[model samples]
Target: MRVMELVRFGGADTAFATRELPQPVPGPGQVLVRVMATSVNPLDLQTRRGDYRDQVALPAVIGNDVSGVVVETGRGADDFQPGDEVWYLAPVFAGLGTYAEFHVVDQALVARKPARLSHVEAAGLALVGVTVWEALVERAGVRAGERVLVHGGAGGVGSAAIQIARALGAEVVTTARARDHGFVTGLGAGTAIDFSAGDYAPQVRAMGGVDVVLDTVGGDTLTRSPEILADRGRVVSIVDISEPQNLLAAWGVNATYHFVFVSPGRAKLEALGRLVDRGELRPVIGAVLPLADIAQAHTLLEGGSPTEGRGRPRGKIAIAVHPLDQPPHGTGSSGREE
Candidate 1:
């Protein structure tokens, strides 16, 4: 099988090397999948930059999102059979990741891919979808009629968060670049504030604040979030905290905090699939590159957004491990651009 390996920890140009490896055999309760597509995330950038060097060995296959077809099943793996379409978030920092033509994961983590989504779409949604589900649905307990604020609304998780919050009957207010206002709004964000224009907290607070805040950008977000949080509001952060923050303001309003490091499970995917099938959720893909262009994908993600001329897409950047056909027409949100 062909694989892209992180040979060293450094810039995208110097870190990756392509190599051929023997296909892995699934263990008991596992399934061997022929990978069709995968996608990059902020975690991929951190991993490439050696942020998690202590957890990963050199020459590692590092990626989590996967959408593929079952090629083989191990003993006792009765949930799926050969040729079943599936998607999953591979265990973080476990064994080899999904950056290869073949991957093996336990059946418990795999879910049937939403029939309405293409392989590229399913691959793009896997990690971000599951993360947003955990943060908004499970952790924050977002409900109908509530106002939810999402930071980095044009990015992968933020984009998903916006739609999911709306689907749950919450009104969405999101932060994005002025140029991306249309994009985020198309994803169901009722209000879009440009964070760079000035301090957005005051602007958001003027709208009576929000019941929930989903933070995808780390720096100073924790310290400033309370300023715009409604009484008893929940703040769920998926970004890693690199610095200490004062939560004194949170004490006054009984603010609840949740820091999510997502773990994979079939149930979460099924929940997302239900939303997708109901036409409430759709994957937003910004670009689709072949597997050999993994290095370029990393570079594009590390760069800024499309408006900044870095050419970063508004949504997920999918990598095709195998040749993929065009997505079914009208399977994407209006916010999506290729």
Candidate 2:
């Protein structure tokens, strides 16, 4: 099997290397997947740069999301079988990842691919879907009719969060640059504010404030979200959470600040699959690159939304691990299985 791995922690191009390794067999309670597609996330970039090295073991195969076909099943793994199409979050530090042609993961963490989406979309959704699910549904306890503001609406997690919040009946508001307003609106955000051109806090207040704020961009954005919360409303971030006490005190709001790490879990993955199958949610794939061009993908992600001279991307960036013709079963037109 061929895998792209981070042999060292540093620059994207310098750390990632392609290596040939023996195909792995599934262990008990595990499934071996022939990876069809994988997507890049900020977490992948952070891992490559050693930002989480103290928490994640070194020499890691770093990708987090994968859409693939079950090639083999280990003993006690009765929930899945060979030839079943599946998608999952590969365990970050403790397990091998989806950056390779094949990956082995716990059967409990694998879910049947949504029958409506393609491999690329399925792969793109796993990590972001799980993160958003955990933050809004679990941590923030967002309810229908409640107002939710999602920061970084055009990014991977932001895009997924908007769709999930809308499906759950929440009035979704998101912040993106002016150019991405249409893209975020198309994903069902009721209000798309230009973060660069306007003040989100005041804009949110004019619309009855917000019950939940999902912050994908940290720094000042995360710091200011609490100010717009409607009393006991919550603020959850997948990135920086360094000033919880100060932010809470300054805002005078009952806030629940959270740092999201999308853990691999079977139940959540299955729930996400059901949502996709029902057409209530979809993964927005901004770009797709061949596996060999993963370095370029990382470069793009690291650069954030492209600047004026650089071509900008609209959604998640995916890397095709297998040939396009060999895409996993149940794939759909949107590059997702759902």
Quickly count the clashes in candidate 1: 0
TM-score on alpha carbons, each prediction: 0.94, 0.91
Cα lDDT tens digits, model 1, 20-103, are 888999999999998889999999999999999999999899999999888899999999999798999999999999889889
**Per-residue lDDT of candidate 2, residues 1-338 (tens digit):** 78887898888778878888788899999989888899998888888887888976766677879898888999999999887999898787777777888888889888898878888889999999999999999899889899999989998899999999998899999999989999999989999999899677888888888988887887786667667888888878788455543464435777667777768887888888888877888888888998888888888887743454555466799988886654432334222333
Q: Which stretches of candidate 1 lie over 4 Å from their true place?
A: 304-310, 325-338
For model 1, the local distance difference test gives 0.91
RMSD (CA, Å), candidate 1 to true, equals 5.1
Score residue 262 of candidate 2 by CA lDDT: 69
Ten contiguous residues with the weakest lDDT in model 1: 328-337
Best by TM-score: 1
Off by over 4 Å in 2: 56-58, 242-245, 304-309, 326-338
lDDT of 2 at 245: 39
Question: Could you say which candidate leads in lDDT?
Answer: 1
